[model samples]
Target: MLRSSIYHRPKNNFAYAYDEETLHIRLQAQKGDLQDVTLIHGDPYIWENGEWIYSTSSMKLVGSDDLFDYWQAIIRPPHARLRYGFICNDGKESLTYTERGFFEDVPTHCHYYFAFPFLNKIDVFSPPSWVKDTVWYQIFPERFGNGNPKLNPTNTLSWGETPTQSSFFGGDFEGVINHLDHLIELGINGIYFTPIFKAMTNHKYDTIDYFEIDPHFGDKETFKRLVDECHKRDIKIMLDAVFNHSGYYFEPFQDVIKYGESSKYKDWFHIAKFPLNPGNQLSYRTFSFEPTMPKLNTENKDVQNYLLEVAEYWIREFDIDGWRLDVANEVDHHFWRLFRNRVKAIKPDAYILGEIWHDAMPWLQGDQFDAVMNYRFTNAAIDFFAKKQTTVEQFQNELVHVLQSYPQHVNEVAFNLLGSHDTARILTVCEEDTNRLKLLYLFQLSFTGTPCIYYGDEIGMTGGDDPLCRKCMEWDENKQDLELFHFVQKLISLRQQSPAFSKGEFSFHAINESLVSYRKTLGDEELLIIINPTNRSLKVKFPTSFADSIDLWTNKHVSNDLMLNENEFVIMRKMK
Candidate 1:
């Protein structure tokens, strides 16, 4: 039987012709219906010195939509060559072509070295539409590791002597930069930094100056270097923006606290009275009870302008990929709407992820944010597998509900994580059971929403709440958990190559309390993941149709009674 292939180019909305080599192409049709499709990749005519020069030597397979339903690849050329396109193998005399798109014209920089590539191109590749369905790793700067002693905090007492809220162990931007290769090996394409802005606390949330880079981490020049270095590796950096509040020493807050109602910043805060006594206990304010961390009066025009300007400065100057808005829901929606519009106007691809734990469908209503942190999914998985709080049915229901609730695009962009700076580490929460943790980890990574791993989760670093969980990076033998670390790396690699794991639609089959099965299918590729979260091993029966597929993790064939040992999972890929 001969397969037939067709070529079609998607409509582009913006100018600045795109390089087809940089774009991701997906072939959509019924499975096994199309004939052999050959994808011919090439560079556009570049305006070098004077005239245009056609650069060739680029070629790639029109990869299977069964493996990858969407065509996505980063277009890169030596230096800043702006012109590129592709030649499709549609069995016709003339090859189908795409207009040359400028790589520099896009808002976000592509991190090819750190990410998995559809094709190995000489030029670094940009992220295609399919890249959104990924697991992100959020790094808390001060807690990650101390790669450079010179960049240590000057005012040690400010953050305190311990590892908790009052403590500041030396963790710097260089530490993050040094570990770029480690992260790449761990399978995290995107890196999220907690707060890099200058602040008085270990957790940069109590932002002292939004404009300046924290001296403890390094100077502004060093921050830029970090961005450049990470970009070269294809890793996107997402910085934390604590816009709803400011530290006590912030200029506006200082003025309000020092001059009472007479101060111009009095309006910037929710002050209740005039002429406040310098010595008197002031009760008037917004947000939490923390006196040092004053909630900004977002209602004020000047206040809003100041914060928005700060955001623009980072995007324009640093070329940061995106911002993770802290305490996002606390601020005004009107301000967020304006803020989002401003950001998109500057960089359409720049993502704005909100930090809201509860049901965040309201924020995802529209332009407010690209996605919110998916805590419900993470929490439910932990409860079912680690804490033994509920049955697999409970976990499966919660997972289905979240996916069905949001629009396809919105759900695709959601940031899902097993652990973060604010909570206990996933491995620690699982009580250091590498096997059980592996089951939970696979669940989160393979599930529908985007998965984000805490910095140390890949290395199997463990700690409890606050200070304990905030322990320094321990590369030494006594502290390292190699088994857990390698497991994470393997899972990450599997995710990148498996189309069903990356871009497939999620559908689950409900079994008894001990077992749950889910399917992720994209065109000809079908992946079935069955998890048994209980202590006893059992033989589970699936519908008769699954009799011919091969288990992905273990290359074993399956039929009616699929056997999964205690705390084991079987990932099968159906082959026709």
Candidate 2:
């Protein structure tokens, strides 16, 4: 037994409140160390004759990474509080584990056990129930479509023209309305639009007006119609919120520039100097040294009220379903809490997604954002699947870290994406290999969390980062990759029709250097996905014998020995 490798805690992902009544506890041990482990737990106050009376529940070996095996137990304490310990057996001997570390004998006192004092309902990490099953399609509105050329900005270029940072091709809400069938046909249930608020740039990250829709994108009435159209089709809309900074033309920032230190709105932004210098990044804190965007002082009461009111106005008036906060990590935590409360008061099921690129445990504790754009998931998948820069073992470990970083609820709604407006298209990243693109989509759609497909990604569009990636949507069917589109459509269709896709417990295995296999199990329903990332044929042995199983891809019965061709994959599900 590797005593030093045993690990557990009564907080975060290890032991967390699945709900007001249930607590999910997990323990970690060195891989292949313990044969059996059991949870010994009881209410902290449940003591008889100076001895703590407890119940024992066997823990399931959920998963194993390169170095550790994860064990989990779901318990419902009678009084919503628990003092727990673990008993491990390696076949030769047994040992008792507690808060005080290893002990030869089980401790009788409650203090010797780990404690979950109370399972508070408010602290439970609850995101929108709809988000877990949602298949999000991220739309960069400026480039998606153009249904209303009359609303185009002056000197707008023709559609499909080469894109520059400031270029516009007149993509309007009417255009999106016209293309609703495209998304529907592709099976998208959620839309995440980059900022549509009135802004200077086509991308709209630099907000000029929070309340008004960009005329280039259409009027507020058109946007409301768009919202109504989406809801009618059972699709949800999530708009971007750029509260971290304001554009150079933003009213408050303009006022600060005009009046310098004497402006009443001076407190709204972080203005370092009396004479405003818009060209220098040092004049005031901006969004990553861009002088055009001045950082907002979210700590100000007026600023908080203004932003929160803007947040409330959209939900109350437009009935927008969600807010995808831009540069969310730079914003203050208190403001987000206020924003969450205000948004939830209007719509309790509203998803608050943040654009945070790193570990975001602090912001996802049920008090602030529901989940961040899962860039960690993005980078790992790219490194392993797209770039081929990481070994299979390393890829599995990286993903395990991501899954273990958050509670189960957080992972469920995590905005997992392969590419977005901010990054290069996945096809381009794979060097235009349609085979590799297929592999990427297969992994993403089948993995845990709500997966997002960037606009044009499903149709095999390829471009580099930023301006190049933000090209106009190919309206011509002949130019689009219909086969790839159909493949993606099939994946989304499978996800919607199966509970295991979104609700199952996910586990990834390092099958070999060239093949990846993962399983999703929900009760007796289980799906095992195997992929071959190389150009050569590969075979994966069945992880276990299934009583009755069928290959979901070919819709045929499968055998234990299966050969997968280059860039080929299979989703095998157990049959009743």
Task: Write one digit per residue (lDDT tens) for candidate 2, span 1-576.
Answer: 899999997797899998888999999999899999999999888778888899999999877777888888999998999999999998888999999999878888889989999998888888889888899999999899999889999889999998998898999899999999999999999999999999889999889999999889998989999999999999999999999999999999898888889899998988788788877437788999998889999999999999999999999999999999999999989999999999999999999999999999989888899999999999999998888899878888888878877888889888999999889989999889888788889889988899999999999998998898999999899999999999999999988877886578899855666778888888778888888887799876776655246878788877777788888887889843
Off by over 4 Å in 2: 1-5, 31-35, 88-95, 509-513
Each candidate's lDDT (Cα)?
0.68, 0.89
Listed per candidate, the RMSD to the true structure in angstroms reads: 13.5, 1.7
TM-score of each: 0.75, 0.96
The C-alpha local distance difference test score for the whole of candidate 2 amounts to 0.89
The lowest-lDDT stretch of 10 consecutive residues in candidate 1 is 107-116
Off by over 4 Å in 1: 1-133, 154-162, 275-282
- On a 0 to 1 TM-score scale, where does candidate 2 land against the true structure? 0.96
For candidate 1, write residues 1-576 as lDDT tens digits: 111333233322111113333343333323343333333332233336653444333332222322221223333444433333333333333333333321222212221101212233432212225337455788888866676777676654322234656676778888788878777777777888899888888888888889999888988888899999988878787889998888877888788768776787788877767654323465556447777777888889999899999988899999988889999989989999889878877876787889998877667755488788888778888998878787665676566556544545566677888888888877888888877788888887887667888877766777888866776766564667777778878877878778787667677765555787877888888887888877788888776667777887767787767677888888878744
Deviation in Å, model 1, residue 130 alpha carbon: 6.0
